[model samples]
Target chain A: MANVPKLSDPQSELLDKVDVFIFDCDGVIWRGDSLIDGIAETLERLRKAGKKMFFVTNNSTKSRAGYKKKFDGLGLTDVPAEEIFSSSFAAAAYLEQSNFPTDGSKKVYVIGEVGIGEELDLIGIPHLGGPADNDKVANMGSGGRLEVDPDVGAVIVGFDRDVNYYKIQYAQLCINEGDAEFIATNLDAVTHLTDAQEWAGNGSMVGAIRGCTGQEPTVVGKPSPLMIEYLESKYGMDRSRICMVGDRLDTDVLFGTDNGLKSLLVLSGVTSEEKLLSPDNSITPDFYADDINAFFASETATV
Target chain B: MANVPKLSDPQSELLDKVDVFIFDCDGVIWRGDSLIDGIAETLERLRKAGKKMFFVTNNSTKSRAGYKKKFDGLGLTDVPAEEIFSSSFAAAAYLEQSNFPTDGSKKVYVIGEVGIGEELDLIGIPHLGGPADNDKVANMGSGGRLEVDPDVGAVIVGFDRDVNYYKIQYAQLCINEGDAEFIATNLDAVTHLTDAQEWAGNGSMVGAIRGCTGQEPTVVGKPSPLMIEYLESKYGMDRSRICMVGDRLDTDVLFGTDNGLKSLLVLSGVTSEEKLLSPDNSITPDFYADDINAFFASETATV
Candidate 1:
């Protein structure tokens, strides 16, 4: 609840204490298919300064391997697949953590794309009800009824391009049984892709199931503390030494501030400094800068 | 929000004043393919008493012609297609009321089945977007981006069995254009067909677009005054002489009470007298019966 500090120049004095740096991918490091100016160089310098790096994203449409390819496609070198944590992978990890039946007996009725399917496959979890044969179910009975898969013990939803009434019907029936676990990748309403306009995000699919079933999902994406929790458990990183940087205050900044981590807002993506300082927004960052490059430029001046 | 009256047996005095009887089909007339016993005879007697008959339903998946076919399949006699006021048809009527361009220059982007498409076609209203190419759009780009048709001036949603991300994405963009009218058939959360479990209704699809775009739709189904407005304007129905008969409270009964029309609740399908009279529920009907047969049994006594 502290007043947002003016981030004219970030000091290495603050960076020297940071052991882990979590970067939001889409708006922080890159915009559309291009990287922000001087961001790659800034990451390189941060790496040389012994700062551990992790890329966290709420985009559940891609798997970790796919994210790695996206990183490689953008010429972001030295980032292995393990260093990337996507919401789709976070959902897989959440199910695995909850011991979703891996005995080959129970399966997760997935309502997402291949990204969610791949993550579940990597974690040795069985799944059914994917994006395959969407039209077959679409043209079914008047009520859009489908036979129940008795083996479905969980219902997981992400960014499903093939979201149909059949999937919502089946998922509602499964979750309404009162035993299946419901998990959502994120609740991001709109995703900003180019500069044209905003598009509906994964939450539309997640919310469709929620609206039908009236059941709350355990969200596993940004600002949920699941990604940071995964990083802590996997790498044993101290929360106090972690610094979060991103363009959105709701997801990236809120994720850091809510967890006692230093959060910075960059103006390269969705939100702006004027909007953040506006009376309508309650979420505020500890610091603000033009972009990651601008934030890093201040670090060089301090050095 | 008045307290629900305890209705044991309806008075024939109320029936004597009734001229137009609006019945909800799914639960009141029949429960999925079988007519309630003696209901056809009751309709015959009512028609003999000079009462006009109309069927109003929130089931948007079927066109009025399709509803007539369904009525014939159930062996219900003497019902015409013009007397059927379905949500799909109502949506068409609503657009026609608004003077939506019929010049073929303006189009309605539909995110529903052929039922909705057929109604628009019958009215000679130009429209695009049907369930035929659902999968083609489903397998399009990863982000499910479709070029916004410049001619689209309205977006209509009903019970779309083929509700995909592309439909929602395109619909959201069209509605976000600030000039396109957003219309939903009904916002029923779940469609109860066989009573085994809950299946998602049009509300699931409508709510998805609402959640994504933060826009409210002009609902045209039960509980909305648009249906009553349509009947009043088209058939010149007198509200005082109209009686709405249905099994559900929130939709069928509320629609009647909201407009000062006498409401009757039957217990054959969804809402029970126990639930209606419960302190938790606010929607109430002026009369209650075991089923349509029971109501007709009382009518015989009056005769």
Candidate 2:
């Protein structure tokens, strides 16, 4: 029932008006490690046409520098570190902007992976309990109490493959007992682990802490204005001239439309045409396309 | 503001009318490993008065045999294993009654401790992924797709000390992608790990899966009526004559009142006098007592 238009033409008026294009990397640019067809050339065309590019991803498992390495590995060698905005980097940026305590007096308790910790380190925010506490088990026997460190000012929960009971319990204790700020890099329920299947995302880990603490985390990812606010503040970009392009509706499209940016939904990833056109689908993107390659399809066809 | 009367006298009419007492172990009989004062004498007195006692605990970490061992270690040598009804046992009983596959055509995937697995094994319900999967990390690297076992018919989530990302992901895959039944032992948010502190309970673990699957689990523990249904079916006890005694308001008190059983709230566990008296407290027990010891306080005083 959605009245979204298909962006088939390379010279579409919507594409012409957009000064900046904010893209979600995993689904839009590539599916797993394989880059989408014509995406590299489309980016080259967009850049030649004087459009600013920013790759925004809710994946908190990798830092901006780490993301740059992934980009390089994936043959997107020109994608600068400054243009890559990961949820982990946004978390660190949000904390820095909020004037969070960076000294040894107070630190962050990470319920995530190395990426979040690495970003925190970049911002000079002291932290503990990420990969370091992954193997640590809770002593539930006699005289077993998870000791709460008095120095934890915030608990940053992100996508962690190493998430366990000890980290979950420790995060819960820090938030409930220690009165630490609860922050989630993203609340994405599931993410595509590969081209084959979807896996549990950071939201699952955040849900555990939220369950015990009876608290809502300040989400620093897409659909949450925190990441956009960070981007806008850092780059001074015009929101009206920016178009957000991605595959997912709940995070990517909602992130764009909610924040006053135009959104384009691509069918090359998790979502399909049936899903987009479904009556039950609440979120409607401004524009729909077969894929990001649709941007410069005419030129590619002519070639 | 609750009009619950104090059960101060042994000759109280409510105590005399009850034939069976369903007690929650953690906050009712003991705090951690240390037994509450006079609980032993209280149980003995109740037994002498021809009252049947059953300890119903949401703690899924221990099986019935394990609980019996703990009871004997705590000097309650007379307490039998048959009288102990843990959530883990309730889960097995529920599955067996429901006629779940036990001939190995389909098995259960446990997102809990050994207790749940042990109970499943007792009922001849084949299961996998408990403490054995504790050290197993999810392969988030290339070609990392969580291989869902085709034999998994149900995913049972309990209070697991060894809960990890791999187990959580596998359970989600089983329920979401594999069409397996989602079952939770209990959903208690926080439990008394010690008298000094409350730790994240089974609900926290359940919450993580709930987040990813977007599915409500069939809870088998307190207040769900599943445990009582299992108990009633097994023991043929009259619900009206049974009194549920526990320290917690949500699980124990709610379980009793919801199941048409007389409820007694003990102040010795998680719920304090201030909490019980608060207008915010919605759950109201039929009677309140200092502890189970209050049952024969006058006799103890004389001694």
Candidate 3:
């Protein structure tokens, strides 16, 4: 029994020790479309207390700008686009920082949604595939090769509702035959489709490509130091004063601890309390709470 | 260096020691639609010598009858439909032997091609989702649950060029939530699209479902003894008199050795001599040949 502190009061000493708060959107702020109980008010309170807040999500289906619209739709209008860091944006940022091919001689072959394309477009990187290739099917019956675009220098894979055999085969060909670099936006296994259901995530799509190519992709999501390193270099934030809050033990909590920051686990999303307290569980969070609502719970309430 | 005997003479002692010859189709007999030179004549001679033969292919894209068509097309008209054993047919055979839900109570859900569906139809097993679900897309934007057919008792995944996210997600839902059994036809990493090209196989599609469900499937392909055990019981063959021949070291040679049978490697397809003789390679074949044609080459020619 690890004695993990429960942050049940607004004036908890752990809250005063942190100057910056990083939150995961799906489970912490909202599950699917609906907002979490008092998460909006909790953010406003934290903002009033002079704490800087940023939302980091592994969902690559949306860019940072797209995530801003989602926040607004959930009535969290105060959350700005600049404070959001999505895996889609991280992939583009990673490529831009690494000096990826900028010339028209080579382009990225995307096996994902439009958000990845939009992010690449913002960075002025030429790319093809994505939603456009969703309906495409390979002519396997013809006993001919699927034409590999010689200009493809990289294959960026992310979450896609329209993932098909064409994209999987094309990505495999690009990486195995075209000698293209493989990049994955995230590797989260299952994602919340709604408050009660879980669906296959981008990791499943990436696994298919990995199976055939027999190569591992450079993952750019949580638990990977890519995004956090970008945030540190861009904002110059002190790692010791930053606290990460999320519902997943593998991605959210591991991301914070692996980067030498504090993490808080919430029981509102995918992970249940029983799973966290299980004897075999090794990922220990700095703090645990019923939900983000517990952060502002009255001191007179249950300890 | 380990001594792996090279078979060059038709009167090699190894040939007389074996009564049954199980061959892999793509690389041993042919590469794509083009049959290897003298392979048809070699089979005819082997039959004349009273050696029983069977074509065992991990290619689940076609059923036994479909493979017979390919054999006839390649001028191997003496090869009967019963002699062809495809992974698709093996999947159905595996389920039938296990006495899978024979009544109308539950059905198998297929995440593969028409071949798998056809094989299931042959065994009088009701199934859905194969080529029929190829064009289906998940309504991910709505954040609604993808309907899981409660009638699905098992999910049989094989090679499918029409594999899409809908099938992956649907299979995941059925296996994880609906408690359906997971069955994989084969786990071969790649398959020949043409002699010059290779594409992602059913293993990659199976990998996607395994990724989300976190479950291992009962693989019914090469290297697994399920098909070999079925053959042994059905035909009452002696294991000591069986020889497995193929081009791959992982599936073909491993399959034979794992099942206590002599294995022969042919260099007409994927594995090259360098790879086979590599110091780090652990899978050693009982015999190696340049191609099937080398089996009948004159002893005085080179060896």
Candidate 4:
């Protein structure tokens, strides 16, 4: 129950300790379509200082290329598609690293958007069953027998806007009846898009499939250690030298703390200082800032 | 810990104690349009012997009228619509009995099918927002803003073929933003429509809404005290003298045992005798029969 320290001024000593910094997008670096002020400069400065950097996001609605497009739109010249590690990309990377059969027979049944399809396509994992017609009246099957493709070896659940009974039924059927691996992008309770509204996250869809099949899936996003493990092996980043910087507590903060990396929380998006400092809250960030810009306000790079 | 006695002959002693008999339809009386042999005769004999009868089913896809239609097709002349207590009817009956203000403004946001809609209409509780077009491509909102109607005082979840992200989003928005009563028709894990395939039941939909909103809804169907309490209060049925008979142990048997009523398990449906005799299983029925007809095949009911 220690008090969460708020770094109003730049803490160069803490910043200097990290070999690699994983930044969460949306709130920390950008909001929707707009980049946060001084973030572009901070990334450039950090890169010039020989500090390795990557953007880790739970947003599975977009693929790595799609995230790169957003970074490009923000005029981030150095950050390419490889630097962005989204849940979508993580899902794809997981399949490839697991060596999920290179034989032409195996495929993935996707219950998500184009981002999931794009990511799977990037890794040469042929996927089917994305964006099915979810019209309620039209989908009333006579026997309720879901068609399961023999080629589908895994079922990937992400933030599906078209998450319907048909998709869930098919997903559950594939997982329950067949020897298919069940994987989820994230298990966020509610996704904060704006200050006013919190929409149903991919957890709802994943939870529905879970409820139907009475089975748990391997979550591939934040706090799961799958993405962190990916980064650790791919970049060969030391756990002690890596820092996770983000805005959310459950996803971003827990992702860092659970994986032995330091977590830095910003008040720019979801978490307020009051809740962060509350006694009941167990998940706490190592350091807090008003925003990503505030974190490095008066710091000179170690280089 | 006790043995669930498999009754090959009539157990007149157990049947003699109960004044009312409640039957679960699908597995007990009929299995998808094909009536179980001698079930109609069993109902008629039970009715002739002065034992009151009612049908309690978790299938929310049918309204009371729709259920009556199926009953009529099966030549169940004695079983009126009033005797059928479906989860849909239970949801409406609970709302109506609670006097969920009939004043033209307050309504329920239904995330279910036409059956639930019909039942709510029968009770005169107006509803909106069900099974909307949730095609992932078209549903991307600017701020994840859900269109919550101010007049919606409650959100009812049931077996929905069109259970989609849009309906879930609206239901979550209404529950999170407003003081709306969250109600679920049932929470069956997997509704076995046929012997080979099991469809995702109302539990999946309810759990999705629960996952999105982080709020548990009041379940009105089997095993929940809502239906038992409704039946008890409405019929003034004696708890000790009432019997719940069904094939499944989870819904029907649990519904009885959880309450004070005696539970009778029929083996002609889902549960095998080995499971009933399993030492690991804690849920035990008061009596067991091969089928409904077998229960009354050899003896006369106590008048």
lDDT of 4 by residue, A1-303 (tens): 448887754556456678888998878888767788788887887787788888988778889999888888889978978889889998888888888985657989888888888998877788887765344332344654666687789999888777767787777778888888999888877775544567788878887887788888888888788877887788787898888898888878988899999888988877888888888889988888888766467654432
- Per-residue error for B183 in candidate 2, Å, reads 1.1
Runs with alpha carbons beyond 4 Å of true place in candidate 2: A9-12, A278-282, A299-303, B138-140, B194-196, B278-282, B298-303
Interface RMSD values for all candidates: 3.4, 1.5, 1.9, 2.3
Candidate 4 falls in which docking quality class?
Answer: medium
Q: Model 3: number of clashes?
A: 0
What is the fnat of model 3 with respect to the true interface contacts? 0.58
Q: Give me the TM-scores for chain A across all models, comma-separated.
A: 0.91, 0.93, 0.91, 0.91
State each model's TM-score restricted to chain B.
Answer: 0.91, 0.93, 0.92, 0.92
1 against 2, candidate with superior DockQ: 2
On lDDT, the leading prediction is 2
Candidate 3 accuracy as TM-score: 0.92
Residue B72, model 4, lDDT: 92
User: lDDT tens string, model 1, B165-281?
Assistant: 778878878887647889999888887654555678887888788778777899888788987888789778889999998888877888889999998888888886678778888
The positional error of residue A35 in candidate 1, measured at the CA in angstroms, is 2.8
For every candidate, C-alpha RMSD to the true structure in Å: 3.6, 2.5, 3.0, 3.0
Q: Would you list the rank order by TM-score, best first?
A: 2, 4, 3, 1
> Per-model C-alpha lDDT, please?
0.80, 0.86, 0.85, 0.81
lDDT of 2 by residue, B1-303 (tens): 666778867565666788999988877888777898878988888899999999988888889988899999999999999899898988998899999988888899999888998898888988989999988877767776778788899999998877888998999899888979999998888876655567898878998998788889999888799877876888898899999998888778888999999999999876898899888888899889888887777667888
- DockQ (0 to 1) for model 4: 0.55
Misplaced by over 4 Å in model 4 are A8-12, A132-144, A192-196, A278-282, A299-303, B8-11, B131-144, B193-196, B278-282, B300-303
lDDT of 1 by residue, A122-193 (tens): 988888887763544532444544677788888888877667777888887788764778988888878764
